[model samples]
Target: MNDPDFPRRIRDAGGRVTAARVAVLRCLAATEEPLTPDEVLERLAQTAGPVPDRVTIYRAIEWLAAHGLVRQLATVGRAARYEAVEDRETHAHFQCRGCGQTRCLPAPPPPLPPLPIGYVAERVELVIHGLCAACRAGERR
Candidate 1:
């Protein structure tokens, strides 16, 4: 994704797209998998000059998340992973117990259960945990 386009999107979302913001967005777009803030910092360091501190990354993530541009996934005993929010389908994640790898899997459409009389549901995420293919193979061995 182009930096100009990314900054434009951030501006459209009422955000100021600084170099840090563009770097973070570019890093997220480059990956097929979601990444934690530390992973994001590492990738940014390699390509985007000196990496922004974790505090800056956290602030950027908060801004992006608040503007509905990023989605966060909480893993067990680890930092949350984040991805750009271009799609909103119900999905499940396969987490490797051994290596802590997380793979996203498409899930069935959510059932429309009745909400309480005065309640509304905005969003939902269902995550499933298990061994990935490599971990499973290793277990078999």
Candidate 2:
């Protein structure tokens, strides 16, 4: 998605607005699931202009994540995936164990368990792992 506010969002997040950063953020914002750096590069290549190199895409994603403009999802021994942070209610995610496909689920995050006096919760992540519809169908065939 070509969001006109991307540049402004970067600036607001105290980051320098660059083409690679903008493109990376835009690409992530356009997708429903988090994307790896390589996936970002592939999507950018399919777009109508010069695509940033692999390193550039990595740096852009890193910068975005550092700036809190994007959130990196836990992939555990796999390529790190990133998704743009949007202004909405926090939700959970569903990951297909077979295909590694991850998608946002509308389920609200569960309430935080009680913590000790000095504890703090920065974020909540609830991931449901199972086969997606397509993967389930494939297994039946």
lDDT of each model, Cα atoms only? 0.77, 0.88
Clashing pairs in 2: none
Write the residue-wise lDDT of candidate 2 on 58-132 in tens digits. Answer: 999999999998998865446888899999765788888888888888777888789999999887788788899
Q: Which structure among the candidates has the greatest lDDT?
A: 2
Model 2 TM-score on a 0 to 1 scale: 0.90
Inter-residue clash pairs, candidate 1: none
Q: Give lDDT tens digits, candidate 1, residues 4-101.
A: 77887789999887877777776876777888889988887777367788899888987887897777876685778888776566466766777787
Residues forming the 10-long window of minimal summed lDDT in candidate 1: 86-95
Off by over 4 Å in 1: 87-90, 106-118
- State the lDDT at 32 in candidate 2: 88
Model 1 scores a C-alpha lDDT of 0.77
RMSD to native, candidate 2: 1.7
